[model samples]
Target: MKDVYLFSGFLGSGKTSMLTDVIRQLKEKNLKPAVMMNELGKLPFDSQVVEKDIPLKEMLEGCICCSGAEKTEAQIQSLLLDSNFDVLIIETTGAAHPVEALDAVYSPLFADQLNVKGIVTVVDTKLWLHRQTLTPQVRSLFMEQIRHAHLLLANKMDLLTEAEQGQAVYELQGLNPHAFILQTTNGRVPLNLLEDLKATAQVAKKEIIKAPLSAMQLGSCLVEFTGKEFTQEQFEEWVRTLPDTVYRMKGYVPIEGIKNPMLFQYAYGMVQWLPEYLKMPAKLVMIGENIDTVPVIGFN
Candidate 1:
């Protein structure tokens, strides 16, 4: 069985920085690890930050809590089938709820093969204090991630005053009494903390089984198709016919007449294109609200 560790946090909360460090530590211990990164935009910012040798799988344009969950599970399964990794690290989008993402992994398909190691919530102490006043949705998402974490990492501690840091820790303790809390700058916590921390052995499986499907429907819908190749004109025509419910779409597409594969990203009907020199297998993930994947079968 492989340990699945979830690294979740708000925007710019240092989740990526922490993840890079964690991957380095895992490699030093001779553990084969795979990474799954969920991003809000088409840009693979975090992916570029990781070491080139590490295996990385990405789900973009949709929060993990939404249409991307199933795809995430599928990717994990594929990685497990193809490689002999000892652990899987999932770095979720800033807006995602950690619990919902965790719920997605507890599917019957993965129940016997994967174990929940611990949920690590990285917090920007300075930003978290003012988050409540910005927007209700942001606050809800932040709280959800923090509340579900088995270990809370107070990152960017240098940005906060000593008293502010203390206050934040106290508040976090109140929210989750069982979580182990630590403060660090740029997510510099000891590697031992990650290796030694474990999930509660007696967690009720029913809790995961009972989470409503609606809770998982918190983000846009998405469908991803991968194959050896796809035509650019064919992909463009398919995008033009996308439903109104579809708000965001992105992924790598292979087409003729382009030296490198083309990258397409759409948000609220606006689309952008990027030409990349390097190419990989043709894979695309589309994101939208209430998107019906059945209607887009031709693209697959």
Candidate 2:
């Protein structure tokens, strides 16, 4: 069976950066790979970073594990019929839970045409270590993303010490004992890790790993923002004022007089800013404990 690889990771887990490296490896080997990316927000930024040569398709504004699942199934079918690519690489939204996302591909329609290559979930080791203090629902959602992975890419290894890295590996191993764990820096991993041959054994054993229904139903709200162009100063102030319960905030915003979209991210009490060029809408999505306390700001 031809293999279809699903890449699952949490927000800011470096999926795009890692995929860039993987694409280069595939090219070097003359491996024909097609891509299907799921972006949770309407404004898709990572697609631009991907190399233009590869055949790429996208599902936006929804997680492929949920609302986008049917669309994903149809797209994959379309890609298969339309192209002769050797392997299909699907990079799912950080919010995508493997348990749910797998449902999209396990249909009888593609069973013969496609083989489950294995779900490779990426973990930001730095954040993994400190995320225990988050609310139970958030914690469960994070754990749910990794529960059925055939491989776990322990990313951001450079941020940890030797002992901490070991601990991260151990933690991931414990999270999904069936998974093969590998340490990765900046999302780069050995090419063999992405190969169909390497994952066959694990994929054969993968069945659904379900989380509690209650926890599965609860998660951070997907907030939509519009009608405001803020000054740089105002934007900074607003992010700083977000609720303590908010652990992650990311997306792009338009600032007055700035030619490029202002990339924004907030995590672990710190915020980062970057000027990114994308004509997409300015939308901010935050995943955390309590989103109700998040406030909207107007610079006018």
Candidate 3:
């Protein structure tokens, strides 16, 4: 049977970094790994992180838990038939609910051929300490991700002070007493720790995800800034005025006087900019609750 590991975490919680390390470790042990990445927008930005030699399938413009349920099953089946891999790793979009994502994977079509290892969630330690600042719906989403994880990685420990880190761990342990919690920086964890993990008991009982996904109320929109270049200062100012509901935004953006577009990422109130050598589409995909209502002007 092929082992399946589901990586669940909030936006900017280091899921991709963890995935890269896991893939590298698995390769060292002579185990082939296949990846399935889900993104909330038309562009598959994160998929670029996966190397070309790895077998990768991407689902875009939707989350696997709801709109892409059927597609998720199809992709899994495709990977099983076409790839010679010992393990399959699924990286769900940040907005995905853990229960619904597992529900999508429990399809009977090829259930007998797969063994679900466990859900490994990456928690941003500093973000958890300040989760109360988020909207009630988003905060509930964040807690649900932690509450359902079988193995939790409290990531980004470097950003937290000793006192704050202790408080975060205490609360995370209280939320998930059954799971093993590891404090990590950059989502680093020992691979041996994952070898014996079994899917949570909650996964064995699948009734929880039967409710309609509309109840979650998350949304996303893709804004293409094709042919437009903005001054770096202008773009940053616009981002500053956005509402708290805007959880994450990422894409290649063209900046005035720059030879190539820059890779831009925004989560919570923090923004990161990386220089990109290759020219790509100048578009941004935003994900959050009621994100469609978030305004975009001047650079359409």
Candidate 4:
């Protein structure tokens, strides 16, 4: 599976700078990497920063979390099919929400082929300190981005005084106690820091003491079995073990010994498998709260 890393931060927070450095380091290690850049501007200004050889997809004029989400899915599928890269780096617009950006990446077909490394958020320490001056909605969005990060980079530290730097660390730690925070100038983060980081979309139970179910939003991911088939017994067993949070699943599955794919659906603990006269895309969309964590459909 290819590894995926998400770059998220507010405007002028140095996400592009961080992405450049990450690409450089990956090249140093001789690993191939691809990039998907989301820009709200008419043209993707950041695309110029990525080298020509790297497989690049640009999403312009919209945030990946909202208007651009459908496009994001198509672009990712294209990259997966056309490129031969070990890592995929997605840079979202400064205004994008981390959760929605991730939602866009978890398409059922792509989820199994990609290993989500985590969201790395860059913080402009100065702006963070003066965040109270911003409008409430923007401020909340920034907070949400930071809160969901597995790795946090407090960038542009050169502008902060020693005392202010200390305060930024303290307050950021308070906001996201689970993240591994690092202070850097110009977003120069060490690759070693990312060695073992993994993102579990599920929020920790202890952290839920104050904000319960905030991470359990209703979401969906499509599962495609175009080039694969599954045994009916194993497939049913997989469905039976799924959590109650999985409210519904519907798709076509190519069952062993069956001439064509079957139309399958599940809801409220009930399962339905109907015979289909023709072969359709062996894909199903699963919907529920926190469904992004659902394991990829297996074909053993």
TM-score of 2: 0.64
Stretches of candidate 1 above 4 Å error? 200-300
lDDT against the true structure, per candidate, is 0.68, 0.68, 0.79, 0.79
Error of 4 at 138 (Å): 0.7
Better of 1 and 3 by TM-score: 3
For model 2, residues 1-300, the per-residue Cα lDDT tens digits are: 566787888889988888888888887888888898888778768888777777888888877766676688688888888877877888888777775676555433344466556677888889899988768887787887776566778999999999999998988887777667888888887888667333321111112111121212212333333455778787777767776756555666777888756777666588888887765446554544323334543422
Q: What's model 4's overall lDDT?
A: 0.79
How well does each candidate superpose onto the true structure, as a TM-score?
0.66, 0.64, 0.67, 0.72
Highest-scoring model, TM-score: 4
Model 3 lDDT per residue over 98-139, tens place = 766766665444554677677789999998999999999999
Tens digits of per-residue lDDT for model 4, 1-300: 788888999999999999999899999999999999999889778899999999999998888887676799899999988899989999999999887787667664455576666789999999999999999999999998898787899998899999999999999999987788999988988887765665533222111111122342444555556466778888999888888867666667889899988988676698999998986656665655566666664531
Using TM-score as the yardstick, the better of models 3 and 4 is: 4
- lDDT tens string, model 1, 108-146? 344546656667889888887777686887788888788
Q: Residue 9 CA error for candidate 1 (Å)?
A: 0.6
